[model samples]
Target: MTLILAHRGYSAEYPENTMLAFREAAKAGADGLELDVQMTKDGELVVIHDEKVDRTTDGTGFVKDYQLKDLLKLDARFKFASLPNREPIPLLKEVLEWLAGTDLICNIELKNTLFMYEGMEEKVIEMVREFRLTDRIIISSFNHYSIVKSYMLAPEIEIAPLLSDGLYMPWIYAQSIRAKGFHPHWRAAQDEIVISSLDSGVEVRPYTVNKDNELERFFRVNCSAVITDDPVNARLIREKTKQA
Candidate 1:
């Protein structure tokens, strides 16, 4: 069966990266949780998916511009639809602390380039080591420099280079950085491209897959895994589809 990795926790059930969302994802039996990170102005590694806070939270500014203390004050909600007491944006350490002694895997994707956090690669590596999760963590980034910098700093953490349409032959690019896997947007997973990566011993897992038919297509072609926004639905589909 294809491994089902949750994209930013069970984002559909709770706000992405919030403690509630991550707990929901773990409860849903996700094989791994994928989250994004950005360094705050005060040098704390915060778990958030955007450069700015306006969209996902009740705030309006770049995350880089705010100190971690200020960022915590904003309400992180999925609109006003969530249960009144459901969640808040969780610190990366808080997530790690929660994950301690559990078997859930994690993939932490860097939202900004290495330049944004200067020495962020080392900082992230240090945290993963501090948490003693080197074997279970996959560090990834859409920015090519972040990918390369991560590989240079911590080869122990599995690296996956995320690519969108802007880049072609991304398999080659991933290999150049010694990436353990290739995480491309589902639309970018052309047949030859996936096969080329697989042939080179690099697994390819497409991101944010939402439909059964689309997932079946990739599975038929031997793609490694599917990162999804709804892991509970994906797991059900995977079980039923396999039986079919």
Candidate 2:
């Protein structure tokens, strides 16, 4: 069966990357969670998508400029004004600690492609090791170099490259980087590509898959997983596909 991973933790209905979102995603029966991680000025790992806080939070500057304490002050609920309480940016440590108690898999996308957060991989790996959740964690990045560095630091944990555009024989490219999986944009995950890659032992899990037809397609095809903002809808579609 294809796994349903909540993209940014059931972000369709809740403020993304917030504890509320993750908890709700688990309650909705998602198999996993996909989230982004970036480093703060104080060298703390934070769970947010962008290099800057302008888009997601009430803050206006780069995430790298703020100390963890200062960063936590910005409400992550900027996009969802209807939400009542302030949603603070969560620390990687806090998320990992929470994840330790669950059976859900986590795909932690290192947000270092733009700013190159020095030592971010090491810090993330160390934290995962500390939490003893290495087996259930997957480190992914659009920066192939960052993915390679993470693989070197902890080969026991799975690592994958995030692709926005299609790559020729991505499984081969993944093998070159020693990546155990591939997370591609939905369009990049062609049927032949998915089948061939999985046959080659490279797991393929596409991102941001939300449409009912698309969700059912991935489920029927048996790709490793589908990362979507609406895991609840995705889970429902998966059941329908199974019944068919």
Candidate 3:
């Protein structure tokens, strides 16, 4: 059966990457959680999707500009005004502490593609190891070099490359980089790509798979997992496809 990973943690309903979102995703029965990680000005690993907080929070400017203390003051409940609580941007350590208590797998996307934060991989890997959650963590990045560096640092943990465009024979590319999995755009994860990759023991997990048809298709094909904003709906669809 295909696993359901909540993209940014049930983001379709809650603010993306918030603790509230992650908690809700767990309650919704997602098999895992997918989140983005970027370093702060003070060298703290914080979880947020964008380099800038303008889109996701009430703050302006880049995340790297703010120290973790200052960044926590901003409300992360962007566009969710009726949510009835101020959602502070969570520290990666805080999230990991929370995750250590749960059985859900975590796909931590290193948000270092745009700004190559020095020592970002080392910091993230060290934190994961500190929590003893290396086995349950999958470190991914759009920066393939960052992914390679992560793999070299901790080969025991699973590492996947995030691809926005179609990469021909992604499994082969992944092997070249020593990646154990592939996280591609849903469109890039074609039937042949998915099936062949899985057959060769490479995990194929597509991102932002929200539509019912797409959910059913990936589930039916038995891909490793689907990273989705609507994990609740995806879980239901997975059950339905399994029954069919």
Candidate 4:
């Protein structure tokens, strides 16, 4: 089966990265959940997409400038703009605690590519150990070094490298870093790239591939997973394909 990992939780319906979003994704039957994490001024791991709180929240500053407590006060759902209720920025610990009771896998993308968060690897690994969810978590990042450091910190945990463009013979470099999988953008789902990566024993899961045609292409090529905002639709497509 091509795993359906909800991108930013069921973001098409809920405020991205909120508890409500994650719960909705699980309810929609996503195999796993994918979310972004950045460190706050107080060194707290916050589950928001942007380096700055300006896009997703009502706040007007960099995430690194505010503590988690202050970030909590900001309206994270404001960008959704029409919702009457607001969700606060959640901590990584809170999310990990939530995952401990469920069978869902977590693809935690470290949002430190632009603004490096020192000690992020240790903090995340510590949380996974605390929850005993080392097996269920997949640490992913665009920052190759962070993923490498995460692999070094916990060789037991699976690491997936996130890339925007398709790498030429990606498995070579992926193997060099001991990455267990590749989390490339939807554009990287070219047949040759997908086949070569799989042939190298690396699982490929492309991001934001919500459309039916693209979903079909990935499934046809036997990619391991598709990270999407519309898990409901993706699941339906997977089922429909099975019957066809």
Q: Return the top candidate by lDDT.
A: 3
CA shift at 207, candidate 4, in angstroms? 0.7
How do all models score by TM-score?
A: 0.92, 0.98, 0.99, 0.97
Candidate 3, poorest ten consecutive residues by summed lDDT: 37-46
For each candidate, how many residue pairs have backbone atoms clashing (under 3 Å)?
0, 0, 0, 0
Tens-place lDDT per residue, model 4, 1-244, is 8999999999999999998899999999999999999999999998999888888888898999997789899988855878877889899899999989889999999988788889999999999999999898999999989999999999999999999996888888788899978898999769788888898898899999988988988887788999999999999888877777
Residue 25 displacement in candidate 1 (angstroms) = 0.6
| Residue-by-residue lDDT tens digits, candidate 3, 65-125 | 9999899999999999899999999999999999999999999999997999999999999
Off by over 4 Å in 3: none
Candidate 1 ranges beyond 4 A from true positions = 166-169
TM-score of 2: 0.98
With a 3 Å backbone cut-off (N, CA, C), the pairs that clash in candidate 4 are none
**Candidate order (TM-score):** 3, 2, 4, 1
Better of 2 and 3 by lDDT: 3
Local lDDT at 76 for model 1: 82
Ranking by lDDT: 3, 2, 4, 1
Off by over 4 Å in 2: none
